[model samples]
Target: MGRVPVGELSRYLLAGRLSTNGCLTSFRRTPRSRLVGPAPPTLRPLRTFHAAKEQPDPTHQQVQTPPTVPLRKKLKDEAKQARKQGKKKSNADSQTVEGWELTVGIEIHAQLNTPCKLFSSATTSFNDDPNSHVALFDVAMPGSQPIFQTGTLIPALRAALSLNCDIQPVSRFDRKHYFWWDQPSGYQITQYYQPFAKNGHITLLARDGIAPEDGKSVTIGIKQVQMEQDTAKTLAHNDNTQWLDFNRVGAPLIEIITEPELHHPRTAAVLVRKIQLLLSTVDACVSGMETGGLRADVNVSVRRTDDPSQTLGTRTEIKNLSTIKAVEDAIIAERDRQIRELDAGRQISSETRGWSIGSTETRRLRGKEGEVDYRYMPDPDIAPLVIGSDLIAHLKQSLPVTPDTELDKLISYFGLTPKDALSLINIDNGARVEYFYRVLYSVQDMIAADDLDGEGADVKTYAALVGNWTLHELGRLTSSKAGPHGTVDLTFAPDGDCAQVPDAELSQLLYHLYRKHITGKVAKELLMALYLGELEDGVRSAIDTHDLWFKEYSLEEYEALVDEVLEGEDKVLQEFATSAKFPQGKLMFLLGKMMRAGQTERIDPANAEKVIRTRIESLRPSAA
Candidate 1:
């Protein structure tokens, strides 16, 4: 049977369905009218539900909620309804048509954390001067040969293992021939045929775009992880002359391919960010998208959710997406494009596209290339890469604790809530995580050293307090927009170095807070002092210098101060002591005056409230 126009099919299906009596009533209630287009013989629905089972049981006689309509179908139905009603359609309605379920898969290229290139000894550091760190082998010199960097494999292995991939026993390199101005070698070395690892999955929690019933996790499948060489950078000169920076030519990269398991564009973006944080925990990649340290290529397709077979439609590849926002925007735009084509009875072309950052639309780059087109051949120059059991075992032992594991440990061991634990980890930026752990262990050390006050110094409580300070108070101080200098000083050390604030100083400040020697406000001031390098002698010195130490007063003295404030303001006391305002707890307002008169140092708020309430009851004549 030949394909029919979508418009003709829609009109015929809708008109003929009304003749079926109640059979079409259910169809009308659905977000879209079902199409009876000819499907391929093999493309049958996977399963069928009986009509009796689909509808509610007659005995119950209760109304049942219809299944949720796919987003695409809902859009199309709304558009059709607007047209029939002679109303103007909104821009969103004009942008999309119905009946498509979007599926997205992402391929990520992460630059490895290594001192040298993958197949050469040349430095891989970014330099101000172009071509300064190039090796003869990088530029394809006649006599220079490739020597593999075995040390560089550690970072890649750690990444694959952390992602729960199975490391292959034997992997080999292949030459992908491509002629470009940036590739002096005329080919890239990659593990195309037999990659290093494969078959992994990640569970994405519904932290965003979720409803009460939609709280289940979304698991995405990983296809493979392969080691590859990065391309050189091309810089354009003033006269349109192009210069190549060979410094990055042989740099290491790990390419991760995922199955088409993502349904929403934002979900895809969130998964990419999670992967970035995971890799950062192991130092596998620098995890910076702006500097080309990481990039993603998105493959998007759409299908009919109501179709039984759920056959995937033709897919488009969006390449070199450098940011998470770009990934999401490109996928949504491409999904809309495909739906519009299908609704008009046109087939989507399988092609590679580039995302125009300014317009946020995709433009065709080239027809999508198949693996056969690359003519992949085994690299004769390099031997087959083999991993012995002993080496694999050692690498597994050396793998760092994954971020998810750390989150769990923070919760279970420290008795912290999931929110507080996540705040301590700070997945997007590990600076706060670093500070948290440093202070945490430092406080523990001080306790072990028998230096703490030892009365109310609980490790779990201190850990929670540290998380609050780091994420809340310290977070604001360091935030670029909120800070006084337009940036918070997160500088503990320079880039690529392990910089942490002094543990001794941090421990002292934590002790002060735990012992209630300083309020939370005063604790923040102490942290600022330490950050600014003004707390040279330690927490005590900072407290003295800033006059932030809490002042202690005798119990009798505090009671006298409270009595004086209430006695002096007789009218204020009468209003609070016996009026209806007493129910509103207006006595605390006058108690605040007593604390303020003593500089808020001589009395703890809790103690002051208890003492002032007793004094007020005596004045009420009930105590007499």
Candidate 2:
């Protein structure tokens, strides 16, 4: 029997080679000391001899190797270390609300804006008859092999590039096994093992009261973006049964997983919206949460500042959050729940949960599963995807300027403030941002082509005017419900009808506004009339019919209106005569009456004030 040192004991136990039969079976290197005796006694701490020994064997000395922990134990230890590090890092500088430091990571699934499904030729359009878009391959019919859609690849690539991912040239798919009613194949074909993109990052400028006035750039880490198929929709009936609508089955989807870097719910919500805007701008996905085109899974956890090196609190995964409010609300509720648990001395359970929009609370769904439970394996039927130079080039060309890039350009190019630029590209008006740019650039192009010169017709002013109207008035007309923040979607109204106003009419209205033909108010009225179909005749006809043109009254005409006001108001003239300090006060009072008497639009209010003041001064007696 050989005397194994204390450090070697961990290795032996981890290796599982120290059998009950008293034999060391697994060893990478032979020990310097050979086993020469029988079974040893109970192990104890090695004692050092203070007295000098003759020819002492150094091999018998207690030389300890770094303990070799078991693989599972090692992983657990590393996670424990990470949690400690995460807590320390979090407490070092993270913002804490309600005495709890919040940590959140969002996983978003955005349906690719593709005509067909990811692995089959089924239509990906929504609002079709139930099961109408399902193909044999979509339902996993026997002997039905999936053929990948090339169209779906482009959007994924575009999203990956826009999100600052390093696109892997060689990516493979794997089958994730799970038993669910919606998943017909009993497994999902996904790029789980090796995703198409990895290690990306997004810089989020906190808005919507997420940070200080000078909002910090919160850079969230993107873990990976994987291509996967959507499961079918399950509609529960009154008879305690369910019907499967496979229209969404096999639909192309990309899942973006972020690191646990988000600390505020508002910041997390804004980040989700920003990602949605980026995807929509690049034509990667529709990014409509209401239409089931986008979904988010949020992981929320909390810890304390006192225990900086303690493990992070258990996390709860809130699944399938369809709206931004849901994401924010769920995070807040979950974090509060965790804080309450901590305050009550209760342990938080790691579980999966569901959010009820009506109840506005997270309820337990099931215990969270480890990754090994999915049983991932490569799909033999499909080959690995190879993204070559040509495809990359094409994808790069196809992608529009990303949201951040566009925001920077708008701030620099148009001389707009960052807040104003962010307002245009905010998620609420994401879909309409391009339309605004189109109208603005069209005005720019016209100004260049015609070389127009006017008092208020500079490119910057015109661009600002276009942005204001497009983001404000036009957005209101196109949205079903306009709130203080603006609109989220303009494609469908409450009646399920498209709320799109004609871009041509909008362009014409902007032209009139730029050329100083109509005031901003008049332009708004014209837009409303056009949207309501009350003005069929184009922009000019609408303006002329409604008498919305900017009115310009001659100095003589304004003076006459002022005189009429003065004659009707003897009391005002008397007040001015007795005051003697300022005769123009009486004339200024009369100017308001003149403007209200059918000259509001006809006479410039400033010009009226000037003329009335001049007349009053001319009539004044010098020092009498």
Candidate 3:
């Protein structure tokens, strides 16, 4: 066979299944040394697994490499040592409240963007039908063993690194015993004893989407990040009957736990938003929380600031908050509830609660579960997840630029305002920023090739022009008509190309503006025409065709008028060409005559001189 269709292959084969001691071992991309038998010659390119049981099982290669140290570990150690050796001062933000201090933590459950579930080969898509993507292992059928998908491990590692978490060289999964409608298995497979990554931090800045007046520049410490499976969603009907959607069952998830350091609800909201942006930027997690890609458990407790006691108050957790706003509101509600309870001389109780729509009140779901409630044990089917230090180092060097990196480039290199740069960085998953850069560089190249004859273009000043057009003008045009996803047509072609504005047409518009061939008003008119199927030709010809060119003369018109002035000054042209550099005084004198002849004072004196120089060079012969 020449080639095999991907759909034709069974998911078991795609999952890299092997028979070892009558159980399934799911791993792929091995280093080729552990193969017990030679690979089939015909399907060597496809995934090949060994059935004989001599080699160890893992997520990938299991080299004898030590775990990579998290960057925050050293900083945490130093901070601890300093606090132990010296007196500690109360952190202002953490202990801000007078006579009352509210402490909060968050556990965010973000789904990894894997095509399939972690243990099963079932696709991880949201389907309406119950059990649409469930497999035997996902449903906990007897004698069904799980094979770990390597696709799940890479993104988790990337997210860990991005958040400054250390990767454990050897991480294993555990089983937490529970009985619920969602979990068909009595126990859930999770990482309890050894988390994948730990000891990370995410910093919230005062600007770039956050409020400047708040003046926040605090780093919230990350306690741990673990990998686990999601339970089925319990959907209830109008008749009091409920159905379990196993389509969402057994999906891969990363639980990011934060230290109880947040004191403000706004700050907690900002932290969740920051994590969403970071993980999505690195291609780790899906960005939208409303679509169930991510959710959070907001935990809060209130303690008396007047009391210097080491013991804190009872904390309550609001579970499965699907929106960032919900996280903020829930924390605020819980904190206020605790404070009120304390004011009435009542003790706060620990419980898990759910938030309602637009209300500051929370409904209790259950009492908080401790270790004894869910009997935690090691998962027998899956083996330890082994990762090599070499792979970690390579991935570190290959990490893509985050939003902060792009923001700095726009502000420092392009001289854009922070607000303007952030506007670009914060939209359409960075497509707006990408589009702006494309338009700018394309215009720069166009002008360099057309105007400078491949010489030094040096169009840094035009960046402001590009910024204004991209941020204000393009945005205005795109929002004029609402299309799919509440988007107006971007490409201005009425016949067809009425979707996104292509970078080339935008480059052409900017080029015309840069050369002053068309005024700002004319360019805006041309853009509207381009959007509305009014412009007949390209930006260059459209200006003249629509009688929209400004009073300023074109380069050709300026050169033609300069030729008339140079006709009477033959000796001037000869001396100007013979000299190593043209004299400034003589050039200005000639430029004045050229402007007078053209009857236009709108042209730049520098541009007028350029016309004169070119005309003079052409008049004189090229020397050998």
Best by TM-score: 1
Per-residue C-alpha lDDT of model 3 across residues 1-624, encoded as one tens digit per residue: 234345433323543323321212223323357757654321121232344434544765645544433435656888899987885333223223458777889999989989989899999977556777889988899999988999998899999998999888899999999898889888888899999898998877766444333475888899989999999988888989998888888899999999998877777887888788788778898655867898999889988876677577888999889887888777767776778888998887788989986875788899989898998989888899998999899889989897777777888888888888877665555566667777888887777676745565555578878888877887777563423332454532212222445667778988877877666666777777666655556666776676765576778878677768878786777787677765667777887787677755356666777777776667555675
lDDT-sorted candidate list, best first: 2, 3, 1
Question: Following a full C-alpha superposition, what root-mean-square deviation does model 2 have from the true structure?
Answer: 26.9
How many angstroms is residue 231 displaced in model 1 relative to the true structure, after the best TM-score fit?
0.5
Please give the CA lDDT of all the candidate structures.
0.75, 0.76, 0.75
Best to worst by TM-score, what's the order? 1, 2, 3
Model 2 agreement with the true structure over 1-624: per-residue lDDT tens digits:
777767667645554334333343322123447555454432322221244554745787754545445666877899999988764332113235655678898999999989999998878867888988888988889999989888899889988888989899899999999999999999999998899999999887643235452266778899999999999998999979999999998999999999998887778888887888788777788657877788999999999877778777788999999887788778877887888888999999989999988454699999997688889999999999988988887777777677777877777777666777787776343645666666777677666666646433456777777777766675676455543323334553222223456556677788877766777667776777666667767888878876888877777787777777777566766666567588555566677777787445566666778887776666556675
TM-score (all chains, Cα) for each model: 0.74, 0.72, 0.68
**Compared with the true structure, what per-residue lDDT tens digits does model 1 show for residues 1-624?**
446557545534443212222333435444455455443121111122222345436796655445545445777999998888987443224322355577889999999999999999988878557888889999999988888899888899889987888999999999998878988889999999999999988777654322222246777899999999999998888988988888889999999999997877777887887787778777899656866789999999988877859788899999999887787778778888788788899999989999967454689999988787778999989888887778778878888777678877888777677777765554335655766777777777766676556564556777887677656765565666456642445554212122334656766888777778898668776677666666668888768877887877778888888867876677766775676445345676777688787756557888888888887766664533
TM-score for predicted model 1 compared with the true structure: 0.74
Stretches of candidate 1 off by over 4 Å are 1-99, 143-145, 206-214, 356-359, 415-420, 426-431, 447-456, 480-488, 493-501, 545-548, 557-598, 612-624
